[model samples]
Target: MQTNNSVLVTQQIKTWLEQVVIGLNLCPFAKRPYKQKQVKIAISTASDDDTLLQDLLQQFKLLENTPIETTETSVLVVTNHLQDFFDYNDFLNLADALIEQYNWQGVFQIASFHPHYQFAGTTEQDPENLTNKAPYPILHILRESSLDKAVESHPDVDGIPEQNIAKMNQLTKEQITELFGYLKD
Candidate 1:
């Protein structure tokens, strides 16, 4: 049962991934899986932590049951909860604990993205923080094996963050507004 708002939210995320994440080459590994339609964008309408945790577990189970070729990764879009960056950041600890509790630590990993993502030592308006910002709070579930393969094949895996930050720094004010217009709302 998906609502129009859910559909719109999913589309907004897809656009962000395509135009910003992959188009700008922020993630070298993303283009392949995305183009192959192996990326799953799941929208969670949960407004509470408990329900959100359940949704996250379902995503973990889905990835565990599905093959790599069929579904390489999943981005769980949290629509109603964790809008506050601090709360979202705090919830990541519980997300990790859940992985450990389920013994999925080695099998899966979670990457976070949020509308107001801010890295440590960076101000809220810092351009570098824009690197992780998305239309809504997102829990990007990734397969450890696939990530290992990608890292093994890539030449400079450790440089990706620095490179992304540099790219974000290079963007003009107008360019930032153009790319992240949804943030204005």
Candidate 2:
């Protein structure tokens, strides 16, 4: 069930997501092949499920140099799966290049789907809790979320696919607060 507050939050999220979609230039679905195919495919966060991403990549390769705008044929990825050994810059650089060259625009965002409100935590039984515990700029995300936890906490966003994990990006608290206007003490 949703409360009036939730309803308002949803509306806010919808509005922001819509603007994001336009800024990123994304569509719900790619146009049909015979219908001046506008979209290419959906990009989801890296996951155990590669079916969607793979299929989209295949279609994209088939029509190289098609002159589609960055927003026309891409979806931001959203997922919570990853390996321990991951390089952030390398990944972002590669992803950014592909988008620039292919004219694909959108954020490939990822979230751990963890319930914790903070970015850093450790196992309850760990002797030191340092091995698995690492500090992240999650507080910033929460600061962003604080503006409207309901919307920021979306289980699923319908805009472009989120490409990377919800790591601490450079977005300022003010920027996030602006993105979500419900922040209140």
Every candidate's lDDT: 0.94, 0.32
Q: Cα lDDT for residue 128, model 2?
A: 23
Q: Lowest summed-lDDT stretch of 10 residues in model 1?
A: 176-185
lDDT of 2 by residue, 1-185 (tens): 65575455344434433443232233222123213534332223345424433433444454443443322332222223322223332243444455456554432222221111122353433222211121110100011112243345545554323321221133356654553333221
Off by over 4 Å in 1: none
* All candidates: TM-score: 0.98, 0.27
Instruction: List model 1 lDDT by residue over 99-168, tens digit each.
Output: 9999997899999999999999989899999989999999999999999999999999999999999999
Clash statistics: count for each candidate: 0, 20
